[model samples]
Target: MAYRLLALDIDDTLLKSNHRLTKETKEAVEYVKNKGVYITLATGRSFISARKVAKSLKLSDPYLITHNGSFLASHVKEPVFERRIGAETVYQVVDILENYHCHFKLFHEKYVIANKTRQKAQLISRVNLQLTDPLFYPVHYVESPSHRLIDQPLSVLNIRAEFWNKRERRDALEELEESVTGIRITPGGKEELFINHESASKALALQNLASRLGIAPYEIVAVGADMRDRDMVSQAGLGVAMGDAPEEVKASADWITRSNDQSGVAYMVKEVFRKQLRIETPHQ
Candidate 1:
């Protein structure tokens, strides 16, 4: 079946290893976009960070799903849909976080807040650097994260426990989840956790977009790489996993696209994804 909407996860799925859009990928996106395919970016990054890539691709009205689907940004100012972290859950998790040797952060509508002294802010800044030109996304340093969590609605809760081994950290995060309620936990890279409200999911966001467009999930395609991308990738009509994606993620997908370094987004669109749109007509 032909795809009416294309949901693409950034980072490892759309951007190359160096974190820039390749010419081939750009061309591919532009080509499909011109053909009236609705393309949008679904990512774990903030909307501020995701917008740079959207701008590069020249998508003016794309639904930029950011912060792991907690927020859906169609414009620069606000999100069409937002699922904030529960106050009690946030407090519970933050209270639990104090016991670990981790650097954590909270995402608000416009800025990111993290403890001033920790490596979380610096590390995230570095991540943004790789994704775009420097100064693309700025972070806010705060002395009291507790106050902010209590005072404002949060879009995401990120924890980075570099002190523990990757496996250890993942296990620890899983264990921590048992103590908290109404939260969704997913792996971020090797040693980080993306904790959000249970309702904040890429699948939900994709479903909302599909419903609004009067399209079914089977008519939508999603491509992604990381664990956080799993929900939407596996749940989409045609789930595509990048070649560089982990085996677990790759296994969950219906098809495997080329790696990002090889312009996988472009290749998939030009080859695998687009081919499904053609229908043979009966001739007399």
Candidate 2:
């Protein structure tokens, strides 16, 4: 089957252990790109973070479905689609998180608003900066973020906390689910919780993108590694999961490629296009 588009998740799906794109992955992506596949990034990262990885892979004029698909943009420009949580949702979310020992950050199109000016917030910023690639935008620190962010719609609310065990996280997840309306809370990463608008999702965002591009859902391929990636991966005609992906994500995938370190995407891409390439090759 010939897929016209590829929606790739970043983080563990594309980047390897060192949090960098491997040379083999780069060459494979460039090869597929040269063959005219429209490769785009669909990730939980903000636009700034997602765009950096897209450029690193040498994707030209990429369409990014970021902030868990709360925001969509092409070539890092204006959004083709966008979603934001209102102040009420933000305040309610903060209230739930206040009882816990977590550092909360409000995500916007251009800024990361840290909720507390205290030491925990400051420390998380430092740790995140160290863990992440060079930050692309400025983050403002405020003792009370809800007050300042009240009037603005936000891309996401990222909370950083330690996982003493699974139950701590499960309880928090249940609480959020029960307390909120018109909001979505997904805690996939080991130490972070990603919150977005209910209408915002990779599947919904990809549908919008596909409509604008005049592409059918069956003509697209989605590759991802997180639990949050389930929808997009399952919806695509060919859903691929990284070998290291969680069980649930793997269950949703049509096929599982090698681990990210082993160049899973490169492996999957070649296999998917191999048959098409053979058919198109002219007789010598």
Top model number, TM-score: 2
Candidate 2 residue 159 C-alpha distance from true site, Å: 6.5
User: lDDT (0-100) at residue 94 of candidate 2?
Assistant: 71
Model 2 C-alpha lDDT versus the unseen true structure: 0.75
Which 10-residue span in candidate 2 carries the lowest summed lDDT? 275-284
lDDT to native, each model: 0.73, 0.75
Instruction: For candidate 1, give the lDDT.
Output: 0.73
- For 105-218, candidate 1 gives per-residue lDDT tens digits of 666656566655554555655544533333545466677677766786454533333323565565568667778877787776747777878788888888887776677788
| Candidate 2 segments whose C-alpha is farther than 4 A from its true place | 75-77, 116-135, 150-167, 278-284
lDDT tens digits, residues 187-214, model 2?
A: 7665567788888789889888877776
Clashes of each: 0, 0
- Residue 226: error of model 1 in Å? 1.2
TM-score of each: 0.85, 0.86
